[model samples]
Target: MTVLKKLPIVSAVFRKVWLQIAVLLVILIGNILLDLMPAQKEDIHGYTLYKRWAAFLGIFAVTWILVRVVSVLRASSVMGSRLAPNISALLFTSLRILIFVLGSLIALDSIGISITPLLASLGVGSIAVGLALQDTLSNLFSGFYLYVDRPIAAGDWVRLENGMEGQVGRIGWRSTHLLSSENTVIIPNSKLSNSSVLNFNLPFPTASFNLVFSVSYQADLDRVEDTVRAAAESALRDKSDLSAGTAPIIRFTKFNETSVELTLILKARSFPDQSELRHEVIKRIRKAFRQEENLGLDPQRIFRLVSNQSDLV
Candidate 1:
């Protein structure tokens, strides 16, 4: 189906699973034939070398098959899980190396080569290396857990327990990158795994905010609510993507010095949409109130824009 498969040599190798089985059977039979064939004293050394070569080839075949299986699993399982491509690749490579290493050791043992000393040294070295790279190993394992658990993902806004808040950018083997306030923040995976995180884009990304505005005491409460509701409803109808599929909530609060306070609770599909949604709703409502001068919006009072980051509901 691909250009690589269209090649003469490549196509032959991938022709059929039975073809690979046939090659494996040939390798096994060749080893058995080596033992069955009659040999003189002068040819014994050559036969020993041939047997070692055959053993190596057997190991190579097994490793090759295992690596291909790993590749298939990586493509289907890892990629399908929506894991970071580089992390999946790293895991695939690690599995391949483990297979090849075990295969090579088995091949050596088969040829009467002792691997005990090598394994012993490797064990001691691994302990030392593990101790030295303690933090790195912790981050690596934490990263693996983070990827599998999927608590955070790219483009999701997350607030960490330690006052760190941002949108997730990229997750790596060592660190989770965050984009905050136009800056890239690199936090270690270990910290993210252990910390309490609030994801704004999960458990339903729809977020609500309250708009507190006051009108002159002379304004009719019933007329004010009706006018503002119509305006906000118009905004929601026009920008469906920003709407949270909920109706606007209009309620009155307390009395002020010369005006009564009213609150307009509105919902946005996501946190980022709050700005545009609020903008559209406020623009429509203000215009509606202006057209209906009887609504008494208190021209002396001005609307001051406040940051919506803390307007989480």
Candidate 2:
């Protein structure tokens, strides 16, 4: 019954790779038959056939195992982090590629390929290419280090050193794609490695906003403060879409010659929509002030001068 239950599970997995399994089985059966044939009595070259089969099977098995191990490690719950998936994928892919390259070299060596000349030629070629494409190679290695460090991940909201802000879309071998507020930005991995990246999402889910505006100097100071605070409080009062418990603040920042500059700080549930929230606050304040009469005074004061002749009369 246990075996029967597993039959369904086996069937499901095999269904995806039925063709590969069929080919491997055929090769295995043929190799077995060649092995069983007598050395002197066989009509075909059984030894050569067995050697080719062994080489092919060994390489295939190694590649398959490496890929499977990578898949398992990536899906494991033990690795927990936003960047874990991308980091794991990069690490696993690099490991497998290295393993396959080394394995291929060994397999070629076993098959009587001269490795000494190959190594010497590759070394010289590597030096030449390294010098020619130093920047590109630097970025490539920097990307690898970034992957290992696990500082950023796809979908993370980050601020670049140059004042660019965006959510990471993809991490490629050469460049990292950013879905910025303005458009899609592609940053070379090399450039990113050296700079400071501020990951806002990792530290906090909610982002705060400070809206600054100026009102006429003649406006009632208390009413001006009240109006701005009332608008923010009312807009944030329902708190349906926005995150709760964020205190709304309104304060007079500085007194100017013609107007008073005020600062209003509020929390936004979504960081990327801060502009929208600012616009909403401005709109609400304008509408609220418009509804009330003489709430804010005009600060433009006019002065009249008397002539010297009028003073003498």
Candidate 3:
């Protein structure tokens, strides 16, 4: 019974292997036939037109097979899965184009065409084009760097030094797409390369959140601290989004004229959980302050009377 169940799986595997072998054999046989075929007429360079055509076809077949092999390698996990699908496809397409262009030049040379002058002209023309599209090339190169270095990947919450914070949607040749709030922001890759980016999703998803509050200056500092700490503990008790492993920290930051400034630091599971966690913590603290008589947090105001300028003169 087990053999019957595994029979289809084995057959499918065998069929896939056979198909790949058959494709390779076909490409090999085609190239062999092209080499053996006789030339019809000779060109000015002593090479035949038929041979040139055959060479072009052979080059194309070889490039196709190489591309297929690369795809197979990617599928087999030979090339690590760090690259996104779109980036991988783009790289492979670029490789195919480069191979085709080089092959075409060779085929043309095999005919009556001189490649020396063509190569020289292409070099000069490429320099002129490069100067004209300097910014574009910069972005393209920066995009390539981003992909290779992988400081930030798709779906990561990132904040740029310029204060553009969002979730990365896609990384393209020219720009990166970011989803910020309700809008989609397109930032040039060059800008991204130059700017400092903070990736919150990397290393770990846990993020530290700091909340500052002030209590009445008349309240006892130790009592205030203990009450706030108890409130924070109660807030984080049942919340799964708050990291329970790290204990909440409380510190008296400053002494104001009417209030004492206190800072509370805690950990949230991720960036998205920060807002809700903060809200819950604040609500709990506010309730605790109202219920406890010694934990008053109302600000006090003192007024001073000033004489008019004419009276001073």
lDDT, candidate 3, 1-313, per-residue tens:
5673566544433444555556556656765765565765242343455455555555555555555555455454435376666667777667767776776777677666789998999899989999999999999889999998989888888899988888999999889999999899999999999999988877776777787776665667787788779988888886865653577998877877776677788887777676777788877777776677443453232111111111100
Of candidate 2, the 10-residue stretch with the lowest lDDT total is 304-313
Q: Judged by TM-score, which candidate is best?
A: 1
| TM-score of every candidate relative to the true structure | 0.75, 0.60, 0.69
Per-residue C-alpha lDDT of model 1 across residues 1-313, encoded as one tens digit per residue: 5875655434333543334456678878977777687766347667767767777776767767776667666766435476578788888889989998898888888888899998999899999999999999999999999888999888898898888888899999999999997799999999889999999888777878888787777767887788879999999999999888899998887887877777888889887788899998888987876777544454444332222333665
> Which residue pairs clash within candidate 3?
none
C-alpha RMSD (angstroms) for model 1: 5.3
| Over 4 Å off, model 1 | 1-23, 31-56, 72-82, 213-219, 252-262, 290-292, 295-310
* Local accuracy of candidate 2 as per-residue lDDT tens digits, 1-313: 5673666534443444455566667777877876687775346755765676577666665555555555444554544343445556766677767777676776676566778887898899989999999988887888877787867878787888898988999887678999976799999999998889987665565677677666665566787677678877777765437633576777777876766677677777666655566566666776666665553343222111111110000
- Candidate order by lDDT, decreasing, is 1, 3, 2
| Each model's backbone clash number | 0, 0, 0
Per-prediction RMSD in angstroms?
5.3, 10.8, 9.6
Provide the lowest-lDDT 10-residue window in model 1. Answer: 301-310
Query: Top lDDT: which candidate number?
Result: 1
Pull out the clashing pairs in model 1: none
Q: lDDT (CA) for every model shown?
A: 0.79, 0.67, 0.71
How far off is residue 43 in model 3, in Å? Answer: 20
